[model samples]
Target: MRKLGTARPISQKQSARKEGTRSLAKHHHKSFAKKSRSYSSTTAAMAQQNLNSLLQWSTENTVAPGATQPSSDPARQPAQLDPALLAQLLGGPSDADLMRQAMTAILSPEMPQDQKMIAWDNLEQLIESIDNAMNLTPLGMWAPLVQQLDAEESGSRMMAAWCISTAVQNNVKAQEAMLATGAVEKLAGLVLGDADQGVRKKACNALSSECRNFQAGMDELVKSLPEDVWKGKAVDAAEMDSVDEVIGKLREIAARQS
Candidate 1:
């Protein structure tokens, strides 16, 4: 509204100039918004990356710094294996102390059963690391803690046959070393007389090696063992059947081979 007596004249050029300025302001606002969105997204991504790196660093330094000496408290075993230490072990550390510690930890009753199983799987790895250093399992290579592998119980006896068989399969020197223990007669006896098929099956595997070795145990297995040993009723129905089936197969295979 103009004053009653006063009239202001507008020019086309000025009106166009004012409209252009308004248009420029709108474009600037949209551009600023787009740049702000991009900056925020990038900031969030970088922050996530930094957090991940810190977590990895914390675990490596605190939990299991590889090659770092474990605590002196014999009872203070690591609650969990450090991912970093596992990785290093896979990458190959030749430290005998580390290898021994890892092996001992595997069979340690203090460790969870699942961890102990994993430790068993790692034995081949330890064997590879230590093979060149000694011929047979070094004196005190394992321990007296878990002597199931050495006991006289059915399961223990079975594992003993298994261990001897494995020793033979793994190394010729191991075969000679184990055979000298006179474990072969015990294994053949199990194959013929033990009621547990697990013991029988392992005995068969052990005897297979014995036969191939031309050991006298093979004669005992072939000539002296009973024919109906396979039909003996299993004491452990659920666990024993699988091993019995295996022993039956071995008999069939041996018959065919003969």
Candidate 2:
């Protein structure tokens, strides 16, 4: 009877030990699963944050001290183009020479930000004033500017796109020349890939202008743009709207040409 009692208690202890071991194992598994889930959620949230940051525009404003303010009176604003300088640039110096000088001023690392802005403004006006005479061919004034579309400085890229738009607007010769430089593809890439809103907008403007009333230009622009860009993959809502607007304009142009 004493042995039986001792053996029965031992059996109970062994059963309890087995139950405790199973419970511990179950707890450990649950803990590991919870940790894995937590780690995955954290990683996903971090990735989402990074994606949002990349899509968001910088809100920093750095206005130059002496920058001109907007004026209600049209005459108060500085002339966009200096007539004498335009004539000299177009007729006196070769397009290559003028482009080199403008690019040097615009791209110089040591140049003041304000000065760079001035250079861009001047370049835009010069290209606009010259119209089709700016020559966007391989050896034209716009060759260097097209290369600047990929510049490290966002401001430079924006200005370059703006200049290309101004140069190609309503100028079939300039459009053809720009196309020859493979600018259509480059501009489309900017429209789809550039993070800067200003740069993208300017690139879209350039594409719209290039495609206006020109069948060949329209074809080139459409072909250069990727289907994914129009589908709005990875683009923010606002940026997607901008892309849509550009596509709408291009389609309109195509319809008109057809």
Candidate 3:
């Protein structure tokens, strides 16, 4: 028996304490569950955002199907990237863009001659590679550089011939493309008549490269060089035998191919 609410049964006191403890525990568990759900939702959203960014980056940076080098492996998993790093990767210019800018600098009449020379210098380095040399045709670079062979400034003419020589050297496909632009005639004209010695030499180099191992190019070159001018009859006294030597070497190459 209980004494008028002053003293309770030990079992009743124990039961009340147990009920309070259970309620507190249930409330704490509910709060924890809510927090856990929120955390899960946030984590999932962040992961999805990162996945989207990576997808976008991959799409934009994917190499064309016919690229000389493979850009990615299908088996490779997407890498997690930082936001700042992703931005950087997206903001950079592509190889095509750089090439277009260089072409513009080379072909634009309003561009400074010095800048044009620098552009040719840069292109010379690039075209040393077979892929880069092959790229000249599709980019329409061959035609413009060929046209530049007739530029008023001897320096410009020299660079144009030099660029052509560098691009076509040991690159038969590039040589064929240049030949299509009718560059051999202009190049021969430079070799015979250009006042600048450097221009003449570079022009001769281009002619030699174009004609070597390519029968059509060699025929075109022979056709372009007037026999009288190259045979030492019409050349200036100061022209020495250097021009004749080049012409004779080319004739020998042509004769071998025939």
Candidate 4:
């Protein structure tokens, strides 16, 4: 029989077993927490990686190579003129009608890019035909043509410059209108500032044509000509030749006028 007030002795093996179980539980708890932290860190890193990939994809798709950034100015927005509408407008009732229609089509924002180019080429041909006829007395056309010198499309600007150049060819009235409408300043700016060599050449030719026999045109050209023309730096070799030709013609015109 057990004596009163005396407790039974716990076996060393049982005590050690209990201690081992507690130690194992603590170790498991620590390991579980470590694993939870690791899982959380991995998930966050993976989310960050996914976010970076999405940004990269967005950037790659948003802008095309060599594409010009969009201008904020509404005036500089891309033309929206419909090609069909352009064709309809170009269906001429008269020379004045044709000129007005052509100008409208060129400036309209609805025109397709490819068709816009075709329209410009056709307009140039039309202008050339009118100039050859020597009956292009519609001085009103000069104002819109001058406005196109500031068109957002390089093609539009080039065609406008070419048309102006052709219109002034042997036409005194057209040249006077060109000067009066302040086209000389815009043409000079194109010559000095346009990125396209073709555009620069066309502007140069237009300046020369306008200034050939007109003293006022020559004076304006002299005033508007960039100093870089004399410096000869940054000008392309072929473009420089055109520039030199225009300068020589201007000099000739000045001498004759003097």
By TM-score, the best candidate is 3
Q: What lDDT score goes with residue 127 in model 4?
A: 68
Instruction: Indicate the TM-score of model 3.
Output: 0.57
* Location of the lowest summed lDDT over 10 successive residues in candidate 1: 1-10
Return the clash pairs for model 2, or none.
none
lDDT of 4 by residue, 195-253 (tens): 77667777878887787767677667767766654432332223446546656643443
Question: Which sections of candidate 4 miss by over 4 Å?
Answer: 1-92, 130-139, 227-258
User: Candidates ranked by TM-score, best first?
Assistant: 3, 4, 2, 1
Q: Indicate which candidate wins on lDDT.
A: 3
Better of 2 and 3 by TM-score: 3
lDDT of each: 0.46, 0.59, 0.64, 0.59
Cα lDDT of model 3 by residue, 1-258, tens digit: 111113233224322222322333343456546677779798578667767878887876666788654347754434456655454345433334344555666677886665565555555655676887888877877888898898898877887888799888778898889989999999887776677777787888888777666667766776676666444233321243644465566444333321
Task: Write model 2 residue lDDT over 187-258, tens digit each, in one string.
Answer: 887777677767777787888777666657666765676675354233222244644565675444333321
CA shift of 37, model 2, Å:
82
lDDT of 3: 0.64
RMSD (Cα, Å) of candidate 4? 34.5
Lowest lDDT sum, 10 consecutive residues, model 2, at: 1-10
* lDDT, residue 198, candidate 1: 70
| Predicted structure 2, TM vs. truth | 0.51
Q: Relative to the unseen true structure, what is the C-alpha lDDT of residue 69 in candidate 4, on a scale of 0 to 100?
A: 57
